[model samples]
Target: MEVIIATFFYARVSTVEQSLDHQVSQANDAGFEIDEVIADHGVSGVQHILKDRPEGKRLFDKLRHGDHLVVRWVDRLGRNYEDVTDVIRHFIRSGVTIHTVINKMTFDGVTTDPVQQAVRDALIGFLAATAQAQTEANKIAQRAGIEAAKRNPKKYPGRKPSFDRLKTELVRNLINKGLGTSAVAKEVGLTRQAVLRIRDDPQGVEAALQRWDM
Candidate 1:
């Protein structure tokens, strides 16, 4: 009897329009024939763990022995060191292999040499730590920028709303219909925070849209 292995690609993006085409393109460039692609759109990696995410939960359930999991980077797997390493270790222990497209890094449980295994583990830890640190740094920078903007609102009006007229109308209608923020967000394919922004001050959002002539 013979066995066949499957390769799966996973990705997470913060915005709806940010497609996984780049990651898929990278895999193709690397000569990997992906059997499946699991993606979570409009999801924040900083807030959700693999199992907690919509499509991410499927990865744990679907991946099996001899399966290969491909990701663009360690950060895509998670936002912090603990979560990143935990997910990777879980997959490896389950007889699945992990490969990163960026650096061409590979992690598997098939190695027998103690020293080689130690080196691999160390590298994983280092990369995961670095990714976590980067996430924290980005958050800090964003906060600082917001504070600066507060000091001068004219100079920084903040980012424009993501929703257009149609989506905005849809969100407003959902809110008017007495739907909860979470339900409205799910229905409109938006984040809860985005829904809250509109719910908190529909007037303000409208004013901004009018001001910007959007």
Candidate 2:
């Protein structure tokens, strides 16, 4: 008898109206043959662990050796950095491969190469840490915005942000790494002027990111 490997896409829907088919489509476009899509509606990924939600618990128990788990992002696996990391490690130990749509990142659960393992671990740690920081920063920004609104009820919404939260963070990270404006712009698919502005006024850029929740 042969073991049949299956690919599962997990989605955490924050609202009942949210359609996760696009996420499944995204995974398919990224070359994943999804065998199933496990979702938990109205469940906050930031508040619930994988095994805590009804469908989440099923997802955890359904995966097995040689299986693949696809997620829009690692943040879907749990509540924070530690939880996400733990969930990911547990899956790996169970021989379930993990893949994220963004950047087409993958963490092989059964790789034996030491260097590959090191890279996988480092990337997982960095991405999980980044997710945690982003969540905390979002809360702080929301609080500040509320306070500002209370003080000035007539303040208009600032100009719509061009770059998203992830893009802005990426720009900042590249700039911090000493990359030139042209290089950063090319790397992030932004215009030279935009990259130059980000390089010149990082603080204001960060403020825009928070203001627009981008």
Identify the leading candidate in terms of TM-score.
Answer: 1
lDDT tens string, model 2, 15-113? 757679877888889899888899888888788888889899997779989899999888778659888888898899898888998887878767788
Which runs of model 2 end up more than 4 angstroms from their true locations? 16-18, 153-214
- Give the C-alpha lDDT of model 1: 0.88
Q: Candidate 2: global Cα-lDDT?
A: 0.84
Give lDDT: candidate 1, residue 118: 91
Q: What TM-score should be assigned to candidate 2?
A: 0.67
Best candidate (score: lDDT): 1
Candidate 2 residue pairs in backbone clash:
165-214
- Cα lDDT, all candidates: 0.88, 0.84
Looking at model 2, residue 182 earns an lDDT score of 89
